[model samples]
Target chain A: MCEILRLAFAAVFVLVVIITIPTKSMGADKEYGQYLSAECNACHAPSKKSGAGIPSLNGKPVPYLVSALLQYKNKSRKNAVMQMIAGRLDSEQINALAAYFSSLGK
Target chain B: MKKISRRQFTNAAALGLGALAIPNIAVGAKPKVVVVGGGAGGATAARYVAKDSKGAVDVTLIEASKRYYTCFYSNLYLGGLRNYGSIGHNYYGLAVNNGVNVVHDWAASVDAQNKRVKLASGSSVSYDRLILSPGIDFKYDSVPGYSAEVQSKMPHAWKSGTQTQLLKRQVLNMRKGGNFVIVPPTNPYRCPPGPYERVSMVAHLLKANNPKAKIIILDPKPKFSKQGLFMDGWERHYPGMIDWVDPGAHGGIKNVDGNKMEIKTDLDTFKADAASVIPAQKAGAIALAAGVNDGDWCPVNPNSMASKADSNIYVLGDASVAKSMPKSGFSANSQAKVAANAVRGELTGSKVFPARYSNTCWSLIATDDGIKVGASYKAGEKKIDVVSKFISKKGESAETRKTTYEESIDWYNGMTADMFS
Candidate 1:
């Protein structure tokens, strides 16, 4: 009887840990991604074949993108829109975004 | 699956981590969080969740593109003070500094009922909770002749990135003494002062590059942000280079013939060498798909930044109904922090507090000369309220001008660091 009780408790413990662990891990990435992408699409199109005055992001070189962002952040670029954005980022984030775009099929 | 109460976990963590009073709290296993956007609101929110949750949240930011171009400084590019590259940003730090899994994939759809999001790669990600901050979308249907096709020719460079740069290029390439007509949108659009400020910046450029060029603004609203200040600057800086027509003054857009570059109004029909028709806008498509946005913008609880439609979701940035705060990048970053804190609290069962938000927008009238407006906010019952506001004094002293300029740079760095770093 003692052995059975111990086994039961152990099984419950394992099951609870297994289920709650994933929930705790998922965090807000999905929500944040959904929100942010929608916001960005307001302006940027993944392609160069955008309608009207919108520029195409489909095939721009990664290095060029990175350089442009750094200039904006350093205040060498001086546009209000660019300043606000470049001013917001650190070096690490700039690289990540650059990597993502470079990987896209331009 | 060892279930422990909040106090028990705290005690355990405290004892285990030693003198740090590391609460003995056994944090539930970390959940995988995937954020789609890396702009103002998304970046800030991702940082908040990952930081507050410690290792309990595995955040993966999935932005289709790597770099972000803010709409805030595009006007500088228009004014020839900045370049297109200056406004871009990256998201690598979110992964390295915050342990966020930053993915570069297109999120095709969100399956809310299943708690899963679909990506372009045909993969699906399941989450305990989701946040959607997709921002704004142009409603092409509102205007008859302003579909995507017409926009290609008459470029409504209202949105950021390429459209903006293209518009700048077109303006730069226009013949000297040519007409550049800017059709400002009606009320409840993305940046109220944006069109006027843009005209100011463009007029400044035209004055220097193409002195004989003209800019006519057709505004739907009678009143706008710092109207007096803008008019004063236009008169003093770029006299006769810019003209403004408010709908009340018969300046509203009636119809457009894209081929002819003609715009008809109540009183007159005007044709231009170039025209920019900034259309009406609403929340992004995904927000609509998720049923987060009722109409154009998603409505959220001001204090928590949580959605009214679903408790499991939060909305921020231009996509949200954060009226007390204007729909600008600064406002988005501020609101993102609030939303991030609230999400962290929800996940950890920690105490969630009311939030305070602030926004400042600086517009350049000339290369060195600029104007600004700022407001502080507190959460009200249903909305955020502007508690305090300020603007750069009209006649800026040398000291004030220098300080404002320096502060703008600091603000850019500080705010971006707060969001992405």
Candidate 2:
């Protein structure tokens, strides 16, 4: 009986590990996506002009987006707006994000 | 290979382990968190979320610029004491050293109902939580006839980079005894003491070159940061070279004609060889599109800096209305840490931790003379309270000023490291 109990506990531990791993990944995807979007949402919207000052970012190309960011990162484009944003990204994440956004239709 | 029966395998595994299962089950689901603006506040939030949540929380940092230039100590560059390169830095440390996804792009708008952030490139990023720190935007209309086009003629030097450089050049080129006019904005602007610091540094330049040159400060407010000390320093150092005009004295400009280098104020009309007008400001344009900003600034909860207007969004720095915190670089840096930790707690379903913040602003009265103010703060029942505050004591000697200048360098390095490295 003791041996049987030990075996059950080990099996349960392994199961928990498997369950928690995916749980964390899913959480990251959702949460990271949420916070990252808030920054972007400030400028790109589908609705009409939110105000007199801001421009609409409803439809733009992925290549255009990628190029714009790259330029800011490279210092070819001199803008406080572009410089502030592009300075914070990595290559892989920028690519993945670029892919993610490019997939969306205007 | 022979496959063992599921029951047999389970029994074997349990016998080998022998300890309690301790499932440590996940309650519901992990939260999705996205952060915009990779400055002091945004970057700090990303670090906190990544650290506290273990691997449970996801953090994405979207910033528009590839590099960040700190406004603190930028005066040193203007004073010709340091190069601009000394103040510029990248976010590589935040990306490689820390496990963070830093995206370079302008966040166009947030769809609150759908929980989606649309990018300028027609791409949509969905998140359960969003953080925005879009910083400040200049209100062009605040000063009549002052627009982007007129910037070449009369540099604001308010923001960093080219405009700042342009203003510096114009000052350097001015003939001996040329007039330098600095227009200070009304209440609620970024870097309250910045204009005065600029004046002080400019006075140093004139003293070194054209001793006959003079500086005129047109202030909208009656009082300024370290007014007593600044005035005292002026009397001792650049006596009669510095002058001030309050709004009531007809110094406030009603309109600006940039082309002709003329300004018409309520009380007087004047023209100068060089001028700087720091105008009224509001949250960056992006904040308005996200429906986060009211009229002037974004309203956010003091604890987490989450937008009060929207549950999914957070705002920080000069853009957000963190009522207790001043709009200074150091304040922005400290607030970022609080916001980051709060974001981590929310994502992992854990308790949000209380935040204690600190800030110090150092200003140069001359090339060597420096003055500073600092404070520590914590959350009260509903607001933030200053627990401790200090200023440089009476009679700062040359050695102390030199130390302060060196300390300024160290502070800038540490601050950049905290944000990126």
Candidate 3:
């Protein structure tokens, strides 16, 4: 009985850690992405249609957004402004942006 | 799959229990935030604080004008590329959708210690935080013979309203082969590329309407923004129609007779058919009134955009002494986000993110010809520092230029919505 109780507590502990870790870092908070998206909204407004060749970011798949941002960061993408903006973003920020924008599509 | 989902829900439930220890907002009284000016910086900040705070903060925007005209694209309107209404933005979206209180009144004075602002209508509003983005005010005395009293005649047209319309009318009315003189202000003016773009647009109008007419720019500074590009575009499109005379060549503008429409340069007195005299500038009068100004502009804490003079006040846009950042709408909008985050975090205990900023200034030399310069910024220890930058190359293809021009049209739509909607 003692061993079984210990195992149950350990499972709860592991699960809590798994779920709460992202919140502690502030990147995974949907609220943070919503706040950060204010910057992107300056150019990619949801209400306004994209101009020139500027593409929309709302409702895009997470993998596609992440990959595109990564390509821009790595200079594989051709746009000068995108490369400059993407170069400043880290992995977590990119993930957060992708997740936030994807969720907005729904 | 059901068992796994049940376990995940249980984990989240336990975490929610732990989060109960954190204090939520006090429900009875909401904090009040007052923003002055409804331009790029003020509108964006007011909208963000209201939207993100979600009724936790009351936001009031006090602007003198009911409609804000963006100076960024006013040059296009001069060349008949865009209509006057196309560049004007209203505050209805901010009021109805975001729940921001939009009051069209001038902020006459700021009482910093009392944390309230007195409007021109004899009404006053109190606030927990104040944001001032009153933009630039010109120093007409900076020029030898220029003053505010004579603006109607020379028509600075720098503020982009009736003055812009007046200048356009003057351009349209000039006689054939007449000269249009432009006297640009010294360094640290609004939109470093603005006077140059004005030259291009004026030249475009002249080339179509009055081919024999000439446009001359008497620049105080030896070199101006996008000099080579503007010169190249001029040669190709409006060859010999424009002459950008540097200080060395023109010597100096000794005096200007607005009544006679003559500019007495050291070289000679050249009478103009019409002229635009953009004088030196200072921070908007309100910043100085609030005692936040260092000399001509207010110093800000780079990370939060909080006024160094007063902690409860934040300054943005042309009124701020943001190091290395030009006084453009894009820069103002970028700074507004940073200030909004800081304001929200302070008043509501929300998580504050690192301050990031970016600005892109696009100029149209002629129709289907556009160029841009931009930089990304990060909040550094002392100031906002540029992380990376890019400018349109000299020899870009015509296709590229056309695409860039189209992109600017898109950016205007997005930016205005970002500020108001």
Best by DockQ: 3
Best by TM-score: 3
Going through the candidates in order, their DockQ values are 0.03, 0.02, 0.56
What fraction of the real A-B contacts shows up in model 2? Answer: 0.00
Q: RMSD (Cα, Å) of candidate 3?
A: 5.8
The digit string of per-residue lDDT tens for model 2 on A3-104 reads: 999999999999999977874443323333233433443223433322332233334555776787788778797533335455555553355345545544
Interface RMSD of each: 12.3, 15.8, 1.3
**TM-score ranking from best to worst?**
3, 1, 2
Q: What is the lDDT of candidate 2?
A: 0.70
Task: Give me the runs in candidate 3 sitting further than 4 Å from their true place.
Answer: A1-27, B1-27
- Which digits, one per residue and each the tens of the lDDT, describe model 3 over residues B1-421? 6534634654554355324323434445577899998999999999999999898889999998888888989999999899999888889999999999999998999988899999999999999889999999998888889988778878898898999999999999999999999999998989999999999999988888999999989989999988888899999999889888899998988998899999998888888998999999999999999999999999999888999989899999999988878899999999999999888777776666668899999899999999999998888888889999999988899999998898888788888888998
C-alpha local distance difference test of each model: 0.71, 0.70, 0.87
Residue B55 in model 3: lDDT? 84
How much does candidate 2 score in TM-score?
A: 0.73
For every model shown, the clashing-pair count is 69, 46, 0
Q: What is the lDDT of residue A74 in candidate 2?
A: 83
| lDDT string, candidate 3, A1-106, tens digits | 9999999999999999998887645455576568668778877767545455566688988899889999999999887778888998877678788888988753
Candidate 2 scores an iRMS of 15.8
Q: Which of 2 and 3 is ahead in lDDT?
A: 3
Candidate number that wins on DockQ, 1 or 2:
1
In candidate 1, position B249 carries an lDDT of 79
